[model samples]
Target: QTYKFRLYPNKKQEEQLLWTLEKCRLVYNDMLAGLNKEEKPNRLKLQSMLPELKKQYPELKGVYSKVLQYEVYKLFSNLKGLGELKKKGRKVGRLRFKGKGWFKTFTYNQSGFKLIDTNKRLKSLHLSKIGDNISIRVHRKIDGNIKQITIKKHCSGKWYANMVTERNNKKHDKKISSVIGIDKGIKYFLTDTEGRRIENSQFLKNSLKKLRREQRRLSRKKKKSSNYNKQRIKVARVHEQITNHRIDFLHKLSRSYIDNYDMIAVENLNIKNLVRNHHLARSISDVSWSAFDNMLSYKAENANKTVVRVDPKGTSQEYKYGRDLDRDYNASLNILERGLASLPQGLRKVTPVEIEPLQKLETISASLIIETGSLFQNHK
Candidate 1:
C-alpha cells in the first residue's frame, strides 16, 4: 500500500529538491538517448552508465546516488509500460524527453530516506542529500514497513511524499450476511439491488465554469511569462479540486457499501469499448465506474467480503420486466441474479426476489418473430 502525505520543505530544502528533480530529468533524457542507440536495451547496462554519466556531467554528483539510479529504473519502466500497451494493440509513441517543468518526481528506492517521528503534530522526513528538517504532515498513522519514498511536485506547486509500504492483509473472517448487486449509470451513480439510488455528483461538470475562466486567463497571458506560469498553476488547481471531489465521493460511497454488505456484485464492463461512443463518452468517463469497481474489490478483499463481477452483456436490456420498472433497478436485479448463480451453494443465502411480471405481448411477439425469421433463413 502507498500513503501520500503533504511535505512542507523549507526554502533551502525545496530548492535542493527541485535541483535533484532537474538532474533526474536530465539523466532520464540522457539514458533514453543512449537506449535509442543500443540494438538491445539492457537495464543493467543503462544503470552502469550512470557513473560515467556523473563523470561527464559533474553536477549530477550533488544528488544522492540511489536517487540517480532510480531515474534509470524509471526510464526502463516507461519503456516496459509502452511495450505492454503495444502488446495490447495500442499505437504507442516513443518516449519523449522531459521538458523543464514536465519532470515532477524523483524516488529513493530501498534506502536514503527516513521518516522521523518527533512525538509532535508535524513530523520530519530526512533525506540523505537534501536535508533532515523537511517537515512532513503525518495526518494518518503509517501502518506497514516502509519500502520506498517518492517525492512529487504537483502542478499546483505543492510537494508530496508517497511512501510505499508492505504488510500482510488479514482477511475478514466474519460470516457473510448481506449481499447486493449494483448497476452503474451516468444518471445515477449507481442503483443497488435494494433499490437504493446514489446520485451522480458530476464534479467535473460543476467545476467546468471556473476551470474555463482560469484556462481563458491562462491563454491570454504571454508565453512562458511569469503571469503565464502563475495562471497555469491556477488552472491545474481547478482540475485538482475536481479530481479530489470525485475521489472523496467515490471513497465514501464505496466504503459505505463495503461496511454494509458482505458481498457486492458489479458488472464487469468493458469500459474502453463503452467510451467509444462519442456522445456518451463524456458522461461515461465522468461517472468513473471502473475506479469504483476497483475500490469495492480491494476493500471487500481486505474486509474478507466478496466482490463478484457478473458479465455485463445484457444486464441493462435482457431482463424481462414491465415498462414501468426502473431500467437501472431492473438491471440491478439481473446483476444480482447472475451474482447469486456464480457463488458457491454454501455462500448463497437469500434467494433473489422475483419481479412481478407485467409483460407486453408486442415485445414478446417481436422477439419471437426475429428468432423465427433467423431460424427459417438458416434452414433455407
Candidate 2:
C-alpha cells in the first residue's frame, strides 16, 4: 500500500528539495547518455560509477546518494521491461534522456527517509541528507511498514511524499453473499445489475470554463516571464483540482462497492482503442471507466472478494422478454449472469430479480434525469 501526504517544506528545505530534484534529473540524463553509447548496459556497473560522479560533480554529493542510485535502477528497470516487450514482438521505444521539467519525482530506496511524530496528528518526514522534520499533512492513518519514500513535485507548485509500505495481508473471512455487475457509460458513471445508478461527476467538463480562462490568460503572458510562470502554475492547479476530485469520487464509489459486495463483474473495456473514436474520446476520458475497474480489482482483492471482467461484446445488444432492454441494464444483466455462471454453484448466492420491461418501469425522477441523462440511450 502507498500513502501520499501533502508536504510542507520550509523555504530553505524546499530549496534543497528542488536542488535534489535537479541533481537527480542530471544524473538520470547522464546515465541514459552512457547507456546509449554502450552496446550492453549493466545496472551494477552504472551504479558503481556513482561515487566517481559525486567526486567529479561536487553538486551531486550534496544530494542523498540512495536517491541518485534509484534513478539509475529506474532507467535499467524500464529498459529491461522494454526488452521483455520486444521479445514478445511488441514495438518498443528506446529509453530517452530527461529534458528540463520532464523528471518530477525522486525516490529514496530502503533508507535516508523517516517518519516523525506518528502519535501526533500533524506528522513530519525526515530525510537523511535534506533536513529534519519536514511538516506533512497526514490526512489518514498509514498502517504498514514503510519501505520507500518518493518525493514528487507537481506542476501546480505543490510537493507530495508517497510512502510505499508493506502491510501484513489480513485475509478477510467474510462469507461470499451479495454480488453485482456494473455497466459503465458516459451518462451514468455506472449502472448495476439491480438498476441502481451512480451519476458521473463530470469534473473536467464542470471545471472547463475556469480551465479555459486560465489557459487564455496564460497564453497572453510573455514566455519564460515571471507572469507566465505564475499563470502556468494557476493553469496546472485547475487541472489538478479536477484530477483530485475525480480520483476521490472514484475511490469512494469503488470502495463502497467492494465493501458491500462479494463479487463484482464489469466489462473488460480496452480504453486505449476505445478512446481513438475522436467523437467519444472526451466523454470517455472524463468517465474514466478503466480507472474505476482498476480500483475495484485491488480493493476487492484486499478484502478477499472477487472482481470478474467479462467480455463486453454483445452486452449492450442483449434483450429480454422479446423487447430491447435498457442499454446499460441489459449489459449489467449479461455481466451478472456471466459472472455467476463462471463461479462455483455454491458461491452463486442471491440471484438477481428479473428486471421489468422498459415500458412498464416506474417514472425516473426529474432531478435524477437532469443530474445524469435519461436512463435509456438512443437505440438506433
Task: Estimate the TM-score of every prediction.
Answer: 0.88, 0.89
Model 1 spans with C-alpha error above 4 angstroms:
172-174, 320-323, 353-380
Worst 10 residues of 2 by lDDT: 371-380
lDDT of 2: 0.82
How high is the CA lDDT of each candidate model?
0.82, 0.82
Scored by TM-score, the top model is: 2
- Supply candidate 1's per-residue lDDT for 379: 22
Clashing pairs in 1: none
lDDT of 2 by residue, 1-380 (tens): 77889998999999998888889989998889889888999999999999888888998888888899999999999999999999999998888877777789999999998888867767879998899989999998787789998999999999999998887887855545788788888877887776676677688888999999999999999999999999999999999999887777777667767777899888888998999999999999998888888888888877789998888898887775344567777788888877767776666555544433343323233234333333332210
How far residue 217's Cα lies from its native spot in candidate 2, in Å, is 1.2
Per-residue alpha-carbon lDDT of candidate 1 for residues 307-375, written as tens digits (9 for 90 to 100): 999998878787565557678888887887788778876665666654333222111121222334321
